[model samples]
Target chain A: MSGSIAVAGLGPGDAALMTPEVATALADATDVIGYIPYVARVAPRPGLTLHASDNRVELDRARHALQLAMAGRHVVVVSSGDPGVFAMAAAVFEAVEHGPPAWRDLDIRVLPGITAMLAAAARAGAPLGHDFCAINLSDNLKPQAVIDRRVRLAAEADFAIAFYNPRSRSRPDGFGRALEILRDVCADERPVLFARAVSTPEETLHVVRLPDARPEMADMRTMVIVGSSATRTIARSGAPFLYTPRSAA
Target chain B: MSGSIAVAGLGPGDAALMTPEVATALADATDVIGYIPYVARVAPRPGLTLHASDNRVELDRARHALQLAMAGRHVVVVSSGDPGVFAMAAAVFEAVEHGPPAWRDLDIRVLPGITAMLAAAARAGAPLGHDFCAINLSDNLKPQAVIDRRVRLAAEADFAIAFYNPRSRSRPDGFGRALEILRDVCADERPVLFARAVSTPEETLHVVRLPDARPEMADMRTMVIVGSSATRTIARSGAPFLYTPRSAA
Candidate 1:
């Protein structure tokens, strides 16, 4: 049994968004490894083993998956959104960078998914229709100064911003600091969207102005989008549609 | 006889990457409208009408789709990637903004898909693992000045930048100009990935340093990614895996 590993994205809480490629990988896997909730998304099979670990131990989990692959198991590591975007793909590669040289040549692949930002953008009427940047708001991996600088520069570039890991239990004040920076650099009336538990049964989307945007609106499951100056809203009988025009005026 | 319009993405080129939501929209569509190549992707059926148009007619195509929906057809407007990102969703909203007031009440929705940048990033080992921006390099809708400025600012932000519509027939010189700006602003040895026709049988991926990257390497089908300063490549016995580490070292 030749060993190999695949890092797959399940998308943001929607099985309907899972690709056939990802589905095929899961069906063919001899073992699955991931954070607890993501591992729970997979089903039990006769020949497959599940390795579910707690959060914030990404490096350890990645090394374990690699070890399983080396032991002749077809291991599949799963993440909620696209594995490449602030997710497992980087951590897996980080492990490979420092791990044994033989692990480098394993059948390691990164399968893409419909990330949470795209799902939230679709639901909110394409605030990312124009130029945009995605920033991971959590400072667990990087410094706060880097986050603050990126936010200011993204605003100055007039790019719509999508923020991942906006607010988690361990870091409650990060989103508040992000909001303060955006307020200082961006227009006061710019529309900000807080998309919580998107594409799930608990999905809720709230759109507010820059000044009125509060930190507490977002939780661990929330994806925040701060629109560019050109982003606009169309009020109607239902929730309004927000989009940035294709052409710059 | 109620009318509605759903703007959908077919993903890059692979049917497996298409979401069930998008598939559902296509199955229920009474009429499908898009550019020639995109519309050709839809299978022929007795009841579903296919309307394929020429290039550079986004506004016209959007109007036609809206008209069909107004005439009690369940119309699906298709784009190559996610419709909300640099595609049909923004155009449809633009029409509604300037067209009849009743158009505001139309049931228009944006269906997400696996976008080209994400697909390319996954195939290349997550070059966009950290903060990144997506910029459309086409100068048709916006002036060259805007694109130039955005490229410069994105480099200053040290973001892994994804360039969509990087090269086209009439605008062959546009990508060359972009390369010049990037070379001037970014590190000389920064990695650049030119992913052509990703997720398709004809797909080809090429990675080179910034100075070694040429405009001729890309076509209309290519998605160009320029790595940030922190982007690194892990060389193996096989092909190298490119990625920007999750943490700032």
Candidate 2:
């Protein structure tokens, strides 16, 4: 009897934002595996076991889930946002591609969830309402030159950009360099939104012009969205509504 | 007495894909407005008044939603995917920006859901696991030159590209031209995933190489995902798994 592996997304932080499909997957799982914070999001039951690992061990986590499933355990690997977007789904696939040939025969499913960028965009209005690009700003996986080239081209292409993993303790200076490139390429006051811990009680949103954006404004938990030239803002009583119009002239 | 409006995403044709936050908004709404097909997805209850409008009238539909809210009616303007991504959220904000001063005072919120591209990526493998750009291939909103330039730059940037509205009845030749541009820039056999009506009964997925891909493979309902240079495919018994690796060369 072979079991299955379901890679699920827990959504940003709000429990209400999770889909019924993910909730059902959690209820049916005998083993759950993920990062420490994400694994903590799932409730423990009588028949379930939780495996929480530290950061930077995505490949190891993927292998553990695969091993459990191959051993006939119903395993669910959880990610914070959409599993397909810079999350556990990719890591699991990499493992399967390099692991035993039998791993390909296992039933593996990637369930979509409300990603951090989408959740952040919703909280700050539709900053990504038009054509846009989502880039993982951390240079751990890719070269810095690649990140620089993409940001410059994204500015030249006039696409709204959503940046994931903007800053960390070890990689604090990369985001500043990215900002410098954006300022060099885009010579305007385009709105930039730094949405931290979106949908959570500790969520905070800050909007600034491109020239006013600083490196320290973002941390690891923040999702930074830089608007295109066509993006607009509407000021009322509270925070202004930010959006890119449907039509681009 | 004042009323508010909530712009909610229904997700990609699956009831289970909808977020509980959106379900709550629909349950609390006195009026619901959306495109004809999307509005039909909502249940016909005694207290809810459903306004089903035709396509291309997004601005008018948005204005109607604002007017209903201003008239002290709780309204939910439904979009098929995450409202912030190429959907009703931008149109609603456009209406609010151009409407009367009182409209700005109306409480408006955007509740995120699983977008079409994310859902399609999930149904297939995690083809969008790396940095990617989402472009609306429809020329109705932006100039064809703009679309072509963005596609060229996206290919040059080596970002996985997700094309929305690849082909429509009114515009058939744009996707072909866009494909030509990709063929010229990429010059290699990258994978392309054509996912149509994902998560629905009519859902279909086709994977093809860049040279073998045809313009007719996509329709208006299709979400086309072109892999980056780092994307890999694993062939097994059934459909091959497509995913872009997390680390780049």
Per-candidate Cα lDDT values, in order, are 0.89, 0.93
Cα error, candidate 2, residue A183 (Å): 0.6
Cand. 2 TM to true fold: 0.99
Residue pairs of candidate 2 with colliding backbone atoms: none
Give lDDT tens digits, candidate 1, residues B23-107.
9999999999999999999998989999999988888898888888888999999999899888888888888877888888888
lDDT of 1: 0.89
Interface RMSD of 2: 1.0
Q: State in Å the error of residue A244, model 1.
A: 0.9
| Chain A TM-score, cand. 2 | 0.98
Model 2, span B71-100: residue lDDT tens:
999999999989999899999999999999
Q: Which portions of model 1 miss their true places by more than 4 Å?
A: none
Isolated chain B TM-score per model: 0.97, 0.98
Candidate 2 Cα outliers beyond 4 Å, as residue runs: none
DockQ of each: 0.76, 0.84
